[model samples]
Target: MPEYQRIHVSYNGRLGVPVGLFVAVDHLRRAGRLSPDDEALWLTVDDWFIANLPEPPQYSDGNTAGVVTWFKPPLPAAMQRRVEVATGLLSKYGVPWSISESDDPGEIVYEDDFQVAVVPPVRGEPSPMPAGVTLGPTTGGSKQSLGTDASAAARRHLAYYATELADRANRPASPDRQRQLAAFIAQCEALELATILEVGCGGGRDGVALQEAGFDYRGVDLTPEAIDICSEHGLAVTVASAADLPFEDDSFDALWTMSTLMHLDGDGFSRAVAEVGRVVRPGGLVAVGLWGSEPPRRRVDEHGRLFVRRSDSQVRQALSRIGSVETFETGQWYDDGEHYQYFTLRAT
Candidate 1:
């Protein structure tokens, strides 16, 4: 048997270590090394950590034999305990490992021959890794640099979504979204609108569904990768920003967008709404879906993207400038316990 080597795994305050430990525990379970009670405990702890801890910015020196991540300082004591438990589990499995606050190698050897795997934390299912003792070359450093500038942050957010297209595609449509789509399709049928435009149609999920529902649907999104995925599915999509739509005036009978306009700030939001008004014909309908708040504010999501929360009154005020607000409601539409605001408006 090849000798197990002592490897230094660097982790900031994120859940990368616990996820790795999850993999390790799974390996032991498959090999019949973990008792039922211990396996349950490991899984419970892993779930707790994943639910409570924010995902860290993922990094790995591909050629190295360990994980790399960066975290904000003043790590909480609870999180530290979790990390200790993860490392303890690894030690119990006879995998020699150590945690470092910094990524500097100092004296530890992280060569390609060492049995280390640097797995990044992803939403949904854990990404698979090679079986048994296997090592792969380390790729380059972190793909993105953390920053606070609004424009740069927005760009990074789009890039992140572009990369996450596959993951999002695998996820089932949210119940609230399905409800919204059903309502929109009914409205289109009532209005006798044969053509519809979907703004910010990520991955073209809604577009495909709308087409199947017998409406001529065209989609637009800022991310090229999302557009590519939509094209592969045979949906008509264009790469364009909502702030500056490329269609002629009054090009469509109705427009539908959801959870996308929230990415724009106040000024960008106004511009995009103006573009929406310009694209839909007189007496056409527009359905807007967004997360709601009484006091509007801007915040960064887990993927380092900017999101603007608007109140129901604020949404009405914005859309009222272009037409009449026919319907408005806010409710907890997802498991996150946060309410989303949905509005249906008639273009004057």
Candidate 2:
């Protein structure tokens, strides 16, 4: 590999001192965390260090002889724990650390010291930070609670949607839509899937189907009304945000999220995706359905229900790095007199 160099680091407000990359890496090395054979990967500094290292560094898994590699940016956050989250390996290196068994040799990307890396905002798009919304360098401790705000907002949105469903039920899934859903389920059955977790499950319609079809599953929604409705019918359900699923890691075999993720605008969406990957087992499958729209359209419907809609392209881009995506299509669903677009995605 080309000489391994430059890693990214972001400084959060609380850390008090400025440190460089090599110094931080050396500390981990001396502490016997990173292997001694690895040299300080050159780092490019912005507000953070964007380090370019190997795919699965040699020091990674303590194989010291692992391939020398580089990354202009640190590995994405979801895989950070396994790789490492050096706040600034070049800096003072006061960030927290965690350890666990590794499932794959290539899974060695981490956010060391830097708990998370901000994905570049969509091309040429500068999203003015929302008033009162503060996003900064993350610490391992802080990341556990990363999407609390958006998840809270998401819950409220889900509640509104549930009420809308009860007060004015959308026409049942069309034969075509139901067929599509069933076909997806059939594919899962072929895989002998044992469990499914649905986030933003509204009124438990799909969950009910999954359960009736004999699939082991549980669901959560941001809105209590939806959870209550599902519970009354004796379905397993919880009122919680997508970013903060209460389940243990790798708790399920597959996950299904529909028309839910689009509600998160920027980094919140990314964090929620990370949470999904964290909670699902390696090689587990994930399926998502979203409405296709450009940017995110915020509006209130005639019944005073609010929605955050994004174009198909935007949804695909947001999820691109996480896994391979298949089956994206736009179709129409009739809800009363209105037409809604349905865009679906599946990844394993």
Candidate 3:
């Protein structure tokens, strides 16, 4: 019963609010129920908590159909203050609240250094993502292993780019992104590659580079806004998803998908990779860059988007099913032990 024993934190224990209070407030704002001033008021602590805590996969895209997250105790002073600020908002908003030492909430669907998301017993059904979710040195578990197709998960990702990342789309590639483009271009030239198709080519950043490098280039993205931005620069881009590209078989000599496939997993991932095989001729090149490295999980990021960080081994296993991996590289490990994974494969 030691694991179930309660440990009091800086406040008490009410990290669960059908979802986190933070997520609920976000929904409220979206629904036009919460005022901007009031919402901004609560965002002070909401920002801190999200920046400090681990987000449960169930709440990815702010969906909390099942699971409730509880704060893991022995709180840091700074984090404790933030939680208190959050609790204060709960009071101000007139959201009924409570504090309990009841450590046994229910089934532990997710856990980490910062919190645990559980299926409280009174809830009749299993969590939407009851398969389990965790990150950072913990055992990996998620809906991905069950082979559930989350093709729809990319909707939030597209919206994120259309709004929060619109400016980024319009800007030139970041220095690191520039490096990725350079590497991919090198691979293309080495392969005598031509007729490139860039998947998820937001604002055509990489498309422009590929064309300038003297390769015939075309691109596709699901976000209309991003397509518009790319089109403004006179880049040839069509709205499309990686899982379902509107192109002919063996349509290109090479393909590039950078920081895009990480948003998809399960069947969505499989289909996209399959599309890669379908579009590129045998012996053609495919380059992938993802800001992720872990056993695949549907964990939410600080931005509240579904970023399925997949393990290098799993990614290779999948990619190898369609091609032979010829190059492999990774960026410096992040604070949470994840990293940027990049690789090039020759289609079979």
* Candidate 2, 1-348: lDDT as tens digits: 221222423331122212223333433443433221111111111112322222233333543332222242344432232133243233323443222112232323443332322222221322343356443333312121322332333334433464575643234766756876787788789877789998987777888888888878799865445655676556787645676677898888788887777665466678788788777776667777765544446665554334557666666776665656666656673342222344333444
Point out where model 2 deviates above 4 Å: 1-159, 167-171, 300-306, 333-348
Better of 1 and 3 by TM-score: 1
Residue range 18-80, candidate 3, lDDT tens digits: 344554444334333433323433433344455567777887744445666666676664555
List the global CA lDDT of all models.
0.65, 0.51, 0.66
Give me the runs in candidate 3 sitting further than 4 Å from their true place.
1-155, 170-174, 302-304
For model 1, state the Cα shift of residue 187 in Å: 1.7
Q: Give RMSD to native, each candidate.
A: 18.6, 18.1, 19.0
Alpha carbon deviation, residue 315, candidate 3 (Å): 0.4
Which ranking of candidates, highest lDDT first? 3, 1, 2
Tens-digit lDDT string for candidate 1 (1-348): 222322233222133233344445445544545443234334444554555654332332232333533333344544444454556556655765553344432333222221222333332433344366343221122212212122355555665886898788667888877888899999899989988999988887788888999998899876656766887777887656788787999999999998888888878899999999999999999999988676666788777666788777888899998889998878774554346899999998
lDDT of model 2 at position 286: 78
Could you tell me how far off, in angstroms, the CA of residue 269 lies in candidate 2 after the best superposition? 1.6
